[model samples]
Target: MKRIVMKFGGSSLEDGDKILHVANIIESYFKSYSLIVVVSAMGKITDELLKASERAEKGDQDYIKSFTEYIKDRHIKALKASIKREEVQKETVKSVNELCDELYKALTGVALLKELTPRARDYILSFGERLSALIVGGALIDKGLRVKVLTGGEAGIVTDSNFGEANPLMEATFYQVKERLEKLLQDNIIPLITGFIAEDQYGRITTLGRGGSDFTATLLAASLKANEVWIWTDVDGLMTSDPKLVSNAKVIKSVSYEEAMEMVMFGAKAMHPRAIEPAMLYKIPIVIRNTFNLEAKGTLITDRVQVDKDRPIKMVALVKDVGMISLVGGSMVGARGTAALAFSTLAKQGINIMMISQSVSEADISIVIKREELSKAVNSLELNMLGKGVVREINYEDDVCVLAVVGAGIKYIPGIAARVLNILAKEKVNVFMISSGSSNSLSLVIKEKDSKIALQKVHDEFELDK
Candidate 1:
């Protein structure tokens, strides 16, 4: 039997009506393939829960109590509207209350300590999906569809113990998933798997970081070797640029895996970069479609797809609040150990260096970090390598943003860099740092506030017509 994995984001199942609409879409597709649905929390539930968690972390006990009840009430209300059976209603309500109690206990601990660790935060945030899966699965069963709800761990995903940024264990996970899913298909059941949260070898609950549900879906699709993976969200598909930023931004009909990965990494809102990895690994095509607009074909992402070369750049992406640090020293020039020491220093401080570029002689290395960690990173580097011949002057620029121009076709084309810099220079947008690889992708760090203007200037320079 042909198998397909479909993932629905929060907005796709925000309300009762939306969920019913999702159910209809699933029903329509289920006959053609053995369906596995991955669901995120409904609407802003995760955000609301985080706000409540923050209040708890602030020692607001009364607020915690009220917020707990508010969460419980909200889920109960949504369940009431969606599920018609009295028995299922009672069971769901009981399950919801139990989950709330668990959350309340966890929140109380966070309040007493006035600190929320990533592990605790992941545990708290996971409740939203837990609650969502139950509601969605129960509702589908009520609609006469055979369904089973499974947490990410129960659904056979085993990841590393990274707490918030778990990495999947491929072999073990794929085998487990294949066995479980094959059985489910044999029993004629639709498995509604909770996205984002998985377990490590020790059975510890861990999340796949933010925007992880999409990653979860693709991983499952690859593991099960599904015929296709559909990411159903609110938007039609991957647009040329953010629609709000560029009103004329048009939807990309088909995008190569390389293009999609680069776009998401540099801030395209289509899907997370991690979501595409598994699909790319197994050569499975991913369809990004709107759940609300079922008639639309959405964007298909495949490996090595040919794109028109008329446009110099395929897409412009901006990642804001970036800080760039330039490490320069004459002694660092043509030195072998100097580069390793600089990177080791940042690694020791646990600061993630997003983009990096080095000069020909290795005398200067530029690294980009998050603005929030600028002080710590700078201080650590200054203390460790400032006068040690490894680094001389450390220049920090906090108000910078990274714009990436990504496409495979750009590799075979010449003078692309000149065209990009010319456009930005013409717009008077100063480029702080420029880095390009032989892989045909180029990235430039610019003033954070100038990100949008730079993006527009470059987009027009390439004449990316809708």
Candidate 2:
């Protein structure tokens, strides 16, 4: 039998009706493939938990207790409404109660200390997904599908010790996932894995950051070498532009992995960039479908794809609150190791550079970084290469947003830049800095507040609405 992995986001499992909708989708695919369903916490549960954590951090023990009880009641109510079998329902209720107790204890500790480290936050926050997985797994079993619940770690996802933003260690993860899946398949059990949270080699709980559940599904699909991975979300699929902004933004039926990555990297909310990495490495294709509209044709991301030759730019995305820095130095121009040294300094400081441009003489280099990292980045560069004249002024600007116009067909098109600038001009938005890659991805930095307006203008210019 073919194997497939399906992941549902929090929005898809928000309430009793939503859970039933997901169950129907699962039932539709179960007979055709050995299914692994990964689910996120119910809608807004994680957010509520974060608020509870904040209350605890404020040293409000009474408020913390009340908040925790509210969360617990919500989950228990949802579970009761979703699951039908008496025994499974009883066990799930007990499990969730125990999990809530654990969370309460963690909140008490945080309240006493009034500090929430990333590690402790992850430990406390993981309960959301953990409880969801248990509830969903029990509901599925009650629906007559053989199901087993596994936490993210038990599903063979191993990450580094980074409490948040952990990356998977592939070799170990692949072997571990294979072994577990083999045993589960033999037992005729559908594995319902918790998404987002994993354990490091040292056994500390770590989260893969926001949208990490999508990353988990892609990783599992790649490791299992499955035919396809389906990411079921609230939206139908990737659209040409933000539908709210561009009223006519249409769903893209298919897009290349590169295009999808660029979109995600530049603030497209369809999927996380890390979600596509594992699938790309293993050459696994991914399908983005809407749980609400399963019959609709969604976007397919794969290694090989054909593009429309007539289109100059396929999509326009915006990343707000960007900072651009221009490093100018004549001595650095044509210098054997200047670029490497400058980059090394930033890397050591853990500063992320989003885009870069160099002059023909290499005398000046312009780079874009997130606004939040400007001070640290400027300090690092000044300390590393200031006195030697190898690096000159670090001009920083915080009021900027990067608008990326991306498409694989851009190489064959002319006047793409003219179109983008003219549109922004029409909208009366000033372009702060402009940079385009040799790979045909054009990016522009504009004032932060003008980001949405700029994106809409560019989308209008490209005729994306059609």
Candidate 3:
């Protein structure tokens, strides 16, 4: 039997009904394929966990106590609704309570300490997936399937000690994961693993950052050499553009791994950008499908692209709520370490630069980052670069957005850039900064107020709806 990994996002497992729906899907595929199912926490549970952790760190014991009860009650309610077998329900609820009890203790420690270390934060946040995994496994068992639930770390995914955003040491991970999981596969047991949570070398709990579940799925696919990885989410697949912005935005039936990465970087929410790296390296194909709409063929992402002259531009992505900071100085002309210093300073502050452009004269460098990090980025730059003559003035605009056009053909096509600029110009949208790359993407910064208009204009100009 061919092995395959199926990952269901939080939205797909929102409640008891949804969990049953996912279980049914798994049942349909179980006999034909040697299956591994990775699942995220049921709807917004992670967010609630984070919020509760924050409250605990603020010494809000009352809120923490209530939130603990809320979590326990919620999971138990979902458990009762999903697992009809009394034995399964009793056992699963016991496991859920034990986890919830542990959660309460952790929150109490945070309340007493009033400090949320990265390690502690990761530990607290991990409960979401841990509890969900137990519930999901129990449901599957209730259906008479041989199910064994494991956390990402228990499944042999080992990463560095970066508590909140850990990265797997892939070489060791690939070997260890295969060695551990293949046995279960041979025994005809379904390995249901928790997504987003992994352990570091020191045996400490860590997270893979936002959308880490997708990362987990791809990593498993590459490790197991699975036939394919399927990511079941709310959306049909990667779209020509966000449907809210472009009413006629069509689902991209096929896209290259590189193009999908570009799209994700420019605000496509179908999958995390890092999730594709392992699959791409190993040449494993991934399919993004809608759990709700089974009829939709969805999107196929692979190492190769089937080029079509009619669809040169595969996607138009709009990244909103971004701020651009321009570091200007006369001494910056031909300056070697200026850009390096600026970037390093922000790195220390944990600020991620989304887009960057430099003047041809080399006198200024403009970087775009998330709007919420604007103040910290500006302060870090000012304190480090000011009075050194490296950066004379720092100007920033928080009300801006980035528009990106991505396709494998962009690198080979000549007039695509000109046509893109023309579309923005024709719409009277002021282009603040532009960055075109050989990586099959052309990005432009524009006023956030004009984001919708710009997206619609680009979508229509490319005739993506057709």
Candidate 4:
């Protein structure tokens, strides 16, 4: 059977009208495809829920109640507005109420204990996707399409015990997804599936961290071996440069899996970096489309694309609000297990090294981490390394951005990095460090303030706007 998974973001279903619009879009594709529809929480609902959890953890019960009430009202209102039928609306409202009750139970526990466990927090935030899926399913049913809502767990997306960021257990999830979803498809029923939130082996709720929803959808696509996966969002699709930062930014027609991965890793917001992995592994095509403008031919991501031989720089990307830390020592020269020790220490501390560069002389090794994790990474190095004689000096840099040039066959193409550097030089943007040939990407460490102008220059110089 020909099948496809379509995933929509919160921005595409933020309001009642937006939910209805999504329903209409789904209805248009209803009969023609065997579909699995995944949706994010409606708007900033997840953020609000996370904030409420934090406040509850800190012993703020009043704000928890007020925020929980607002969330309940918002989802219920959207559900009612989307499904106008009295009977269906009432029935769906009951489900919404039940979900809200469940959320309250979870939140009340957190507020009482004045502590929020990762497992508990996952359960609390999961209500966003669950509620959105239920409301969207209700609307679809009202439109005369047979629909059933399922959470990521119910849809058979099992993951490890990594509370805030769990990796899916693919082998188990595959069997479960095919058995459940294929049964639904055979019965001519559409699955309004929740994304991002999955259950661990112990049946405890776990979330797949940032961009988890998209990861959920892509995971389904890969497991079911779907023909394609379409990610519907607010923008026109992947652009050469951020449209907000560069006015002349234009939508890329198509991108190879490697290029797309590089772009996302370097801060392109169109899709999650890991979202492309499953599809790329299986050679399944992924499409990025705009919910508001469905007619436009959005970018297609696949295993390979015919490279524009002349313009090796497919995209210029930037990541802001990052911090860099370096460990330097003469003892580091030709040292054995030094890199491994540093990596192991950071891993134990749960610190993600976004980028790593080591000196050829082995005297220094620098890593870029999210600005928020800088303090933690530093403290970890100090405690674990300085006293233990892992290194002599630890240095820090903040207010930096990572700028990358991504394209397929970048290494094979001569002078690509040189051209990028020349463009930056002409624009007078200082480069702090450079790393090339890191999985189809060449990145430069630069000041955050220079990101926009540097991107603009690279975008124009490469004629990406054309």
Candidate 5:
């Protein structure tokens, strides 16, 4: 039997009308395929939940109450409008009550203790997906489709107990999911599934990182050996550049998995960056389509993307407002564990290194990180290396832009660097740092203020709008 998975983002399932619209899409797909539907939180609920956790951790009980109540009402309105059958709505309402109450209790505990554990945080954040699945499942029931709501754990997505960014145990996950979900499919039951939330082997709720719904869908696609995974979002498709930043940005018809991953790593939000891995490994194609514009063919991403050989540059992706820290000292030359120590230290502090460049002379090494993690990364490095004479003074900047020109063709083409720099030169965007050579993508660092203008120039230079 052929199988396929469809995932809807928050924008596609924000309210009752949106939910009904998505349900119709699902209904249409279910006619021929054994369909698995994965849903994210109904618009902005996950963000609101994170805010509630932050406020609760600061010992703000009043705000916790207000936050939880607001989310509760949001779900209630969605459920009331989505499920027409009274009995189905009644059962989903009960599930919603239990989930909302559980979230409230967790928030209350965080307020009283003034601390939120990774476990508690994951548990609190899960209500969005939980309620979303139930609402979606109930709505499907109204259409006379047999449906069941499964949380990530119940669906057998086991992971390590890494609270905020849990890694799924693929072997166990595949075994458990196939054992249970395959049976449900055999019985002609559609699984209306939650997306971002998963479970550790310890039976604790753990979440895949933000934008994990797409990851969830791709994982299932790999496990089921599905023909393809469809990720429905708000945009027409993956564009050469962010249209808001570059009005002439064109929608790319197709791209390779590697190119897509590079674009996402450099902040293109095409889909979850990790979504490409499992699907690629399993040789499953991923389709990015707009739910509102269903007729549009959207973009097809495969292991091998065929394009004009002359123009291999698919997109110039931009990461704006990044910060960089350079550890410079001649005395640090020839230090063996220097790079390891610095990176491991940042790892321990949970700071992600976005990019890195080191002088061949070993006089200095600079690392770029997100602006929000700058303070923590710097403070942790300073405190840990205060006495260790591994390096010298640390100089950091808070405003930098990262531009990644992604495509496999980059490595094959000559003078790509000259062309890139020439475009930047025309835009007067000085490139302070460049990381390239034997890389699938060329990364350039520039002033944050010039990010948009620089991107437009690069896009035009590549003639990607054509």
Candidate 6:
């Protein structure tokens, strides 16, 4: 039988009703294909866990106790509401109690120590997924489907010891996951794996960063060589623009991997770039669907796309809450390793530059990064490159955002860049920086105050809403 992996986002599994809905979706596919289910924590459980850890680190014992009870009550309540069988419900509640007790002890220890290491933080954050997986598994069993629950590590995903934002050691992971899950499939049992959290070679728990759960699903699909991967979220699919920003924003039916990567890289919040990488490498197609609007055709991301001749621009994407830094000096002209020096300086500080543009004269270079990282980036650049003669001046603006026009058809159209600039110019939105290349997108830094208007203008200019 063919195999498929289905991943549900936090929004899809927020409560008992939603969990039951997801179980129904799984049951519909179970008979047709050997299915594996991956899920993230319900609602804002991860965020709450993060806050609870922070509180514990400050030695807030009372809050820690309250938070533990909150987690326990929430999970147990959902468990009872979703699982009808008394025996199964009791078993699931027992597992939930054990996890909650462990969570209380862990937080109490942190409270007493007044220290929260990255390793400890990852461990605490993991309970969200661990508890949710058990509750989901119970719901499936209540529906008469044979279900097994396992954390990412228990399911055989081994990563390096990065603690937080850990990356899987693919070769080992591929071998182990296939060996472990293939048998479960043969027995007609579905393994509902906890997403995001994994273990390093040392058996310490770690987490993949944002969009980690989707990353987990895609990674598993690539490892198993599944025919396709489906990502269930709240939205209809990838939209032409943020629907709130553009009232007419429409779902994109299909896009190439490159186009989707560009959109997510340029700050399309609906998806993340890392989640697509594993599938792209193996030429596996991924479908993004809406759990609430299952009838919608949704979006398909594949290896290639048929360029739309009528509309070369597919999306108007925005990355808000960013800042731009400009470095200028006459000595920078014809200076070898000047850019490299700047890059290494920022790299050492662990600040990621979102977009970069250097003039042909090589005298001035502008870089875009997260607003919160601007101060550190500038300080590092000033200390490493300034007055030592290569970089004479450093300037920065924090209230800025990066806007991008993305599509596979961009390169095929002549003067597309000029047209985009003209559209923004008409709106009186000052462009701080521009970076366009052979890549499938043209990115520009603009004042955050103008983002909404700029996004709307560009979306309309491209007729992307159509």
Tell me the spans in candidate 1 whose CA falls farther than 4 Å from its real position.
Answer: 48-60, 108-121, 438-440, 448-450
Against the true structure, candidate 5 reaches a TM-score of: 0.92
Which residue pairs come into collision in candidate 1?
A: none
Per-residue alpha-carbon lDDT of model 3 for 304-353, expressed as tens digits? 97656766798998888889999999899987899999999999999998
The lDDT, on a scale of 0 to 1, for candidate 3 is 0.92
Model 4 ranges off by over 4 Å: 344-349, 375-393
Report the poorest 10 consecutive residues by lDDT, candidate 3. Answer: 305-314
Candidates sorted by lDDT, best first: 3, 6, 4, 5, 1, 2
What digit string (tens of lDDT, one per residue) describes model 2 on residues 1-466? Answer: 8888899999999987688668878887888898888889999888888788888888999988887788778888888888888998899899989998999999999999999898888888898899888888877877899988988888899999888789889899898988888688667788888899888998888889999998989888877788888999888888887787667788877787888888777777677887998888888888999999867888989987555655667788777777888888778767878778878899998988888878889888878888889889988888887888677676778788788888776666677788788888888888767887744478888887888888887787777766
Which should have the higher TM-score, number 3 or number 5? 3
Report the Cα lDDT for residue 406, model 3: 92
Candidate 3's displacement at residue 457, Å, is 1.6
How does each model score on lDDT? 0.85, 0.84, 0.92, 0.87, 0.86, 0.90
Best by lDDT: 3
Q: List candidate 5 segments past 4 Å from native.
A: 112-114, 344-349, 375-393
- My TM-score estimates for the predictions, one after another, are 0.91, 0.88, 0.95, 0.93, 0.92, 0.96
| Clash count (model 5, backbone only) | 0
Stretch of 10 with least lDDT, candidate 4: 304-313
Q: Which pairs in model 6 have colliding backbones?
A: none
Better lDDT candidate (3, 4) = 3
lDDT of residue 274 for candidate 5: 82
**Lowest summed lDDT over 10 consecutive residues: which window, candidate 5?**
303-312
Better of 2 and 5 by TM-score: 5
